[model samples]
Target chain A: MPKQMSRHSTVLKSPRRQAGKPRPHSGEPTHGPLTAEELQLAVRNHSMPLEALRKDTTPPGLHYVLTHFDIPFIDTDHWHLQIGGAVQRSLELSFRALLRAPSITIPVTLECAGNGRSLLRPRPLSQPWVLEAVGTAVWTGVPLAYLLTQAGVEDDAVEVLFSGVDTGVQGGVRQQFARSLPIEEALRPDVVLAYRMNGAELPPQHGYPLRLVVPGWYGMASVKWLSSIKVLTRPYDGFQQAVAYRYQEDADDAGTPVTWMKVRSLMVPPGVPDFFSRSRILPPGPVLLTGRAWSGQGAVQRVDVGIDGKWAPAHLEHPPAPFAWCAWSMPWVADPGEHEVSCRATDASGAVQPLEPVWNYQGMGNNVVQRIKVTVGQ
Target chain B: MPKQMSRHSTVLKSPRRQAGKPRPHSGEPTHGPLTAEELQLAVRNHSMPLEALRKDTTPPGLHYVLTHFDIPFIDTDHWHLQIGGAVQRSLELSFRALLRAPSITIPVTLECAGNGRSLLRPRPLSQPWVLEAVGTAVWTGVPLAYLLTQAGVEDDAVEVLFSGVDTGVQGGVRQQFARSLPIEEALRPDVVLAYRMNGAELPPQHGYPLRLVVPGWYGMASVKWLSSIKVLTRPYDGFQQAVAYRYQEDADDAGTPVTWMKVRSLMVPPGVPDFFSRSRILPPGPVLLTGRAWSGQGAVQRVDVGIDGKWAPAHLEHPPAPFAWCAWSMPWVADPGEHEVSCRATDASGAVQPLEPVWNYQGMGNNVVQRIKVTVGQ
Candidate 1:
């Protein structure tokens, strides 16, 4: 018997998940043609263009962006970040109050958990990103630890949840765009409540008024348009925390939650592109290749340029900040022929980007190396 | 015989076009599955979120964007807007010099020529927009007419061409992003050399340093990242002017050039949306239906809200500025059942959006009325 379904019961695809899949969607196929839902999501969200790798601090507008729901228009005069739930004394800080708090500005690189989803063989039918979903920005705000301590967090609290005004349904559950971090991790000095990006007030799309900037973790952990904080006594089972952004080998697997960004590198395509095919057409001469490299777990220690599968070390610049991406470059003399160029990065912790994509059901943490093809025209 | 193809000759999809289709792409299908190329373009170029209609002037970060190529990194110190060719006095104005010129700030609504392409049958194989590609921003800069007068246009000049630094190949032609306006239209008091949007310096994505704002014209005519201006004695036949942005009946037609935006109205989807299907769920009773309406041909004079295809005039606020979109709202008693709601706009020039989508080969100037479905759950 076919069961009647109300639209509300239909699972809304998260920014990282496909919609309308079968129940329990275990046999989620690895790859398929892009869907109408995916196209809808793609146009509403955008990523850094590869060419932006040339800049150190990405120009604010060129940074990758993925908003789970509509950007909320906050009236700064009335807006406040309320901290409650299992705290000794709840703290409500107005936008002006937040501005007066001790501020620290630092550069950070943020990459979406599904940065290379489209490159996965059985591509997870989500945003369909082909690399490019990464950017670095200088942020100014108060450290999360500074506020949590001032609010007097209760000892029993196991995690702290952040909630934003943006709301939508995903996985058949209507919910605010929210997430939680473990208490110990939430107290990290680097986690900030940012109000400024680059040198200006936060752009609304990047979460104006107040936003959480969780360094080292994938962008999902850096919640935007934040409105509240809840110190919880128990682990958070929110939709964002327990259901999406997980790496699963099969449908039924509970899946490990994704966190830190993996070591990765991308090159600015080194020639004039054939616009339609995105193939490079270069004149035979010495070509200087350039790119950016980063990782969440540790500093990027090395980058290697792959010319038609042959490896050569590239020069790496000092990282701008603790978690910011570093620029890298190499010189190659062009010959009259077609050639393939690839770049790979290794982090201080020694996690190197894989030569080929490592596929997963939800398509998270895909830090596969990037390769570009160019033809040297005489 | 099967014709051989070189990747170069392959037509790369333009922001408003499809690639690799049958040359003389005349029988371009009206409906088909979304392709990888279209999806790629969608993520790179974003549109306004319908909910943003609530704001009079779109927040800077939420404005719709369509870039045909990578954003150029301009060095303001060295960048200059050179007015040359048929001008009586070829003049070069540095960024600072342009800023020092007389200035004005006004709100202007800009809509993409292909705003509703995705809704067309045999959908145009381009950026598949669904009625969200429009935004209004307050632009501040020198009036373009002021600059032209300073350069002293030669009497023989027929068209004034503007070139941007961003370059890419389109229609198999590698060229900078360029477009031209008739000399008369170029002298309009409202046409401006905008350096600031909504207040601050233009964001890189919106065209930093300098951009052109042609009120009452489709977005393509308002060039960004301006590098130079060439006044031509002969009619301009650049690729952007001659090959793209045209209204055509079939593939082989050298259709009339597309200019003014057609009258259009878009409703904010009333009630909360079902995450997956985007259907609305509302409690039964009186609810406010709100949206924005505008036209490049003339001021939006009226907007009609349709409840189950029944029409009622909505109340419109005086427009924020001559060319900015006006907000409109209507009240409806949503009953407990499935219903379709739609809105249509009529411009002062007597142009009304058609109930049906007006199709075209290039998918330009599609001003179809927008419709949404909802279920009032009792």
Candidate 2:
């Protein structure tokens, strides 16, 4: 009498496959089977695949998920996060009023409103996401200026709005996706609201019950399925703070004045080894030449790493947290086939990393200069 | 004897449901039921589900597909396209010289390069894409300034590149995506190279043996699996023109710009008879609100529509051909219950549509002011 377990046919599966092969879950496995150094640190896209560590920390099922619409639950006793337009006390909060306030943590990295759009030169309509998007995590919460000074804001406010319980269908309209920040960067003091991650409690796909960890920027300005903020003395026409998070022409001309531009990234710079080009050539000894450096603005002073164009001083490693991401490495000595290795960085405010940036019809602030092309042999 | 031929396994199946309620393909198509004029366009994702005489003009397989790194197949005598750096006549051609040049067709619409990041707001990682990304077609080819004047671009070039034969593994960077445009939007003239599409001949998931068709922008500038192009005097730092079609900070900074902004859209403001928070109440008199009006920049020319905020006047049509999409409409007069119904447009260079627009980071060009909500009774 114990053999009646029939519930495995929920139906609907057509992800399509036989029209030229390759399409079963289109590269399936949203998790599992990694390790080649955990697939090069979960090759970005929400980061944390480095083999589910435990001490160097990173396991929350390998943190780094970043979603928006799909994963939305919200009934934590009728959820709340409100805040209110232009402020002067329009509060709301609850998730136990932001877990009883005064909290903190850090270690950021988010990225992806499209990440390396499969190297778009003219290919932009979308999706080709070259870098899996990106990730890092740690997080925690509270601070949004201690709840925007317990909702006091006003003084010609300027914009804060966040809103989310996720709902979509844009273009055909039916929106609800929202965003907005500048109330002095939402009263910074390390702007947060996150409900903890990496140390636990905030997992129903990374925005569990609350979110808004804006440290530097990118990661679509960190807003996840949050709920509401509003403060604006102007600038809040919703539908994602007025026509879905904007950007306008000029990386080469779609026109300009679309605004929002600054704080660029994409690094590699260090010493330049693995076949550093002049057309490749490497075969004499030890090498490493690693990469990765980030920023929304400030902190990252000096990274260099060149090869057939000079410079290679090296020596930096402060980032384990603080909007996280620093990893440098640079040790060389070779000489056989073909090369080119370049890298660059300089932020702390000085900003450098351009061989050509500033073109905006939406190729938004691309740091530039980071080439590679190894070949070396015996 | 023809009955002995039964080999349909081809694998794909699965859309049949009933046991646990997993249905969601609601792109509706019933038939074993429904007959009040087939329940009026049977609405769901394209709407109509009631009205009359819309005689299915391109609604069969439900149009709009868009793929990208998938769908390859080349070999048109080794495919080809090339073009070359700094130019002065480098050319490559093949695919029978891109089907013997001089073509034109028109029709346009393409979309998807992450079309409206699943309606952002705070949910911005990406790909929940409900508008299935748009389509229209009619393509054909040539132009791109006659292949940059048959690859003779010099005069201090200023970027062009394209290269595609698609490759993958982005973050660990096996790389190959490629993109670039600059040189006056790659010699505009509505940019081309397409190889045909609504007039057939392309579909290997669209991009068959050649592709490019830029038209106005977005569609990742239109590159598909094309091969090469190069030209540059400036922009083309690769990685999709420097870290994937970007967008960034500023817009007063609540933050979003991962890249590409401005030229918003979304005014599906017609006959909305449903959806309310501020508008809809029609049905007992005369109606017609209809929607859709585009503009990555230029060409919409008047769409207006309103109800409670009062305005009306709409009417735009004519765009099923060049760069496609125009469609507006307006005629309200029922007035009963809820009502807020908005819609704005104006283009042909006068710009307009902005009850609010200036937040950027990566919700690329989201035209604002589009509302809808309905409820009328006796």
Candidate 3:
């Protein structure tokens, strides 16, 4: 596990790091300590390996783990969920109490708002992500709607704010991790306070005691290690809610808040060389092309593959679970030559992956088309 | 169940009937009789209702069923798989033997190569199809690879042909429904001889005793009610193989043969009025849009949703099973007015759904983008 201290100072220093100069800390954090293994897995400058996308189902341990600061170590016994503010009744529930409440399981893909940030041209200097900050899992927990109903939300309540246990200074503000949603969205039945991931108790890095699983939204909305829920009469102005995570087109205007994930597709790079492997040349024959496509707002409507410039449809496989990624494959007759293969995804909402990513200050939602190169041999 | 007689002569007369004129039999078959129910379900001039695409998972019985002639009643007790030709030894495996063989389950989407035929302009006079002839299912049975290995294919074997018990006259040839694949494809692990669908024994209309399931190919490659497997030293020149199902640019020249599915998408129409329905007028707010997309040649790379001319990416849900269609959704803010919504699919192979279908003689593989109309109320 890695931990960070002097959270506020780090926040103030982020801008200096963003000035396109080499990181002052020389690729090492001055405040946080990371184990060799933890440092090895951190999202420094690399994307999730393209080959990982071919997995039929991502295992929990193997699932990609990403965070803004450092992994917080929380003691489960001391953890509690406090529901207060504009609600008719304020309630404090322990971990056991949450488990005793009515529960449901849903499969959802959680993607960091900056999953493809590194690909954006003139890249922003924040936490550099490159398409690996996403994973799908079956979350089991009590529906947040049930908890809200039990707390007796008042009509005056306009927004629901969730606060997590992780404390850090971000965007020059010292604060606990928090985000808010409109009251109507807070009550969606599919939104849950998950305590388990993929059938096991949630992992420590993922949020052991409890976390908010906001389906169809970017991972930012899913506040991990959740601690408190406040029914607010006014819009939430938490640091995470009103400042850092907001997507701005320019410095002078208030930009749209990053929410659901944009439509995107990534193809698993086929047959590349490894340390023990000697060749990248594929024997001439029918090649099975495969990958995963997803969107935050809806189900994947379709995905198209391109070889150089010629395009064709690929066979889409049924998703193993709802709200999970659909696996797809196509058989390509390998021509003996180098080929640039690409994949594009379209969501049911009619949104297609852009060939070039839309650049933004925060580098949120860079869902451009993905392409890879491969060679076929005689 | 529907049944038809005069299997052979009807096949011979098909070309004469296909010669650009109103069906000479006035929608009634000149050779065989059709039950009233079968005729009613038969596609006349419409595509599968766009509403059907909204289903998260198509129920087994509700899945679309299409056939060339009639549903052949198969008796499991008497059915057996005969494997011969270019093999060291011939093998006759009974239904029981097949059940006892090593088996695996796979989820796959099967689409008629002619699914969008009726949508093509100057519509070719043939088995009219407008996208309904496709469905996804969980197929369970013995791997075709195991059977191929058991028979011990000879060194010179080049092609593998599968024959179904569905005997009928098609394209002027009186024969059983048959298709062939290159030897490499026939040995792939994913190919199976399926006897179960969605966890139950195969339905009569969907090939009861056994069927061939070629995961990434068009439905035509999956011969229904499979009866025999023949390994050949050259390409099998069956009528269905050498003649029909071929794509032709002009009527005079020999056209390229059609294989695998093209990229395509269909939207489940949202909210329509009926006697029991209270209202189709959606309360003005964020509407969740959803649908499924697929391809035969490769995995769907992307799906784009368009409202009039405005397009945005929809969030895609994780696929529930392998080789099944991916469900996708998007949040749309409805404006009060009539709107035309459309979805286009792009496959991993770079094939995109055409705005207008490419007209062909046989109307094979018309993967035109689909559009629908909807109204939003204040």
Leading candidate by TM-score: 1
Off by over 4 Å in 1: A1-30, B1-31, B274-276
Q: What is the TM-score of chain A in candidate 3?
A: 0.85
lDDT of 3 by residue, A1-378 (tens): 001111111122122112342111113212232222221222111223344475554545335554444335567688778999998899999988988999999888777777765566655545545566667789999999899999999999899999887654344344677899888889989899999987877865577679898887778888888889999999996667755665655443355567777777777656542111111345577888889887766678788999996778888876665567888888888888888888888776667877777776667778878766566756
lDDT of 2 by residue, B260-315 (tens): 21233344433332111112333556776666555545566777776778786687
Worst 10 residues of 2 chain B by lDDT: B39-48
Tell me each candidate's TM-score.
0.91, 0.30, 0.45
True contacts kept of each: 0.46, 0.00, 0.00
Q: Residue B255 of model 3: what lDDT?
A: 51
What is candidate 2's lDDT per residue for A1-378, written digit by digit as tens? Answer: 011111111121223222332110112212232212111111112322211211223434333343433345456898877878777879776798678888989877655544433233542332223322445678788888888887788788887878777663333355556778767777878878888876667755566778887865766667776888888888765544433333433222212111222233333222212110112233557776665565656667777777766878556577786566676667878576556667677766666666543322233334456465656566
Largest DockQ belongs to which candidate? 1
Per-residue lDDT for B1-378 in model 3, tens only? Answer: 001111111112222223442211112222222222222223211123334465554444335555554346677788888999999889999999899999999888777777766455555545545556677788999999898998999999999999988664443345677889889889989899999987878865567789998876778888888889999999997777766666654343345556666777777655442111111334466777778987655567778899887887766665555457787776778888878778887766666778876766667777777776566766
**Ranking according to TM-score, highest score first:** 1, 3, 2
- Per-candidate RMSD vs. true structure? 7.7, 22.5, 25.3
Question: Which ten contiguous residues of candidate 3 chain B have the minimum total lDDT?
Answer: B1-10
Model 1 lDDT tens row, B1-378: 011111111122234334443332222645667666666677667888777898888876678888877777788988988999887898999988887889999999999987888888888666678778889999999998888888898899899999999886665677888899888889889999999998888988888989999987889999999999999898887777877777766565565666777778888888775444556777899999999998877788999999889898999888888788898999898889999999999987777888887777777777878878888888
Model 3 spans with C-alpha error above 4 angstroms? A1-48, A274-281, A320-322, B1-378
